[model samples]
Target: MISAKFRVQLPEGIWVADTSRAFPDATFRLLSGLRIGEKAVELGEVIADDPQAIIDRPQSSIDGWELLEATDERALTKYETTDIELYEFVESSALTVEFPVVVRDGWYEFDLTGTRDDLERFGDALDEAGQPYELQSIVGTTDPESLLTDRQRELLDAALQAGYFEVPRDCTLAELAETLGVDKSTASTVLRTGEAKLVAWFLTGPKQN
Candidate 1:
């Protein structure tokens, strides 16, 4: 499979309002979102230096949206529900991909993996939906690191977000295991091996080492 990343500018909505004000720097991992009647229901979290602001700050949607629920932590997991029109647009568009979509600075950034045809279809979908997007990066061939597998990527990504690499380590090995519903040893191995492979891949960079 091939991978690509893009930046999408959604139409005016709550996300636009919130990104402009309350959490300009907040990073989002959208877990689930869809249109429910005249409004959109979004379930996601803010991953940043300060996550509490996301939960406590008041939201403003020029169009229309309602913050149904939010908590101080676990913003990604807990049902931080909201009504957002952007969610509807995203769900209906070709730009939709499997990877968790990241919203920050009022733009949607995401990585997608598929064949060339799939990517072409994605572009077509965006065009059909009238959603303009900027292609940030594209990988046409198989990534050697694709060997890491989907589960490994998810585990490593979660660990990284949980501050597993911090000096004090915000999350313990056991905590990571609990998050992934796996045993401590399994989590430890996933973190260790994932880090090693990712670092080696980065050191190798564009040219095959």
Candidate 2:
């Protein structure tokens, strides 16, 4: 559920855009055929069941984070392999997306030209998994009035109504602050406090069991 902007620099004539498009399907196949944590590496359209196999022959790139392999695919592919411990971080790190970004005016701006599909899938997967984002507001057992200040609730509700969570997500903190008629820091603080309270209420002070 994390919202981020990124830019990637690819080598000339790599057709990486097409690769990314076909990737989801290929990845789907790789996952359904394997077990969790098993490594799968891609060389052109050919994906291997071995991580060491591909790491030994990484493709040349201008400057970008290669998709390599997502953990879910690895785990699904692991069903075909005997070694399972090799893919320990598959659940957390592999499934996670790291978009390369250029800092512009203190905000991360994404390059959506070539890898739009991948970014889309990344965002979708996160939403399905229920992760973090720029304007994430969790539903908690605690009543809104009991957990957050009146102003905090008001701003969050406004942000939600303003499509803050929609992709391409909108509403920068400064912009939202202007809309809410508050200083940027105050807006950020209120949102953070509200989120913290919601999380605390939802988790009920963490598990003792």
Candidate 3:
């Protein structure tokens, strides 16, 4: 995965309004020891990108900020309009906010680059809160089939042979479970988890494009 520091400068006007609508009375809050009014609030996410960026604020803080009140029209303009004084303040402003962005390394990564098969496998892993395997995690194991567990191997084998992964639809999960001599829930869990791990394995060890 590729990792880098990401810093965004938002005009106070834009920042306050976005935060206000996103949060309520408590919006635009500053750090405890910092002067509250001088600094602007920001919201961001570390997403997969050509040049990755990271968001560092805690989830609880994000939730708190989101609860603040809406921004009036005046506040919105502070960040929107280019005021010389505001610009100076922004430039000389002691405000410093920093976060890290990590981009996952994988096959031909671009915005929305993953194939259907890749997305299905990777998305499930993301849902499970699994940190991506470092880029090149599976350099030696080139075959997708080699990365899975026995059950996962069975599931994928069945899905392919029986066309479960097909668009028109193939054998149901229940059918696969019966054929594998496992309970439906057990088989489903294994298949899903295995799929996620398989995707994680596909990405090279963490390195940026």
Best by lDDT: 1
Flag clash pairs in model 1.
Answer: none
Over 108-193, each residue of candidate 3 has an lDDT whose tens digit, in order, gives 11111123444344445434543232232222334556555586687777768887788877788888788878756456555765
Mind giving the per-residue lDDT tens digits that candidate 1 earns over 67-186? 444455434433323545555554554334333567777677866655566677777878887877999997654365673667778898898899987899999988888988986645
Q: How far does residue 100 in candidate 2 sit from its true spot (Å)?
A: 33
**Model 3 lDDT-worst window of ten:** 74-83
lDDT ranking from best to worst? Answer: 1, 2, 3
lDDT of 1: 0.61
Highest TM-score: which candidate? 1
Q: What is candidate 2's TM-score against the reference?
A: 0.30
Model 1: lDDT of residue 17: 40
Task: Provide the lDDT at 167 for model 1.
Answer: 95
Residue range with the least summed lDDT across 10 consecutive positions in model 2: 97-106
Candidate 3 off by > 4 Å:
1-143, 204-209
Looking at candidate 1, the ten consecutive residues that score lowest on lDDT are 73-82
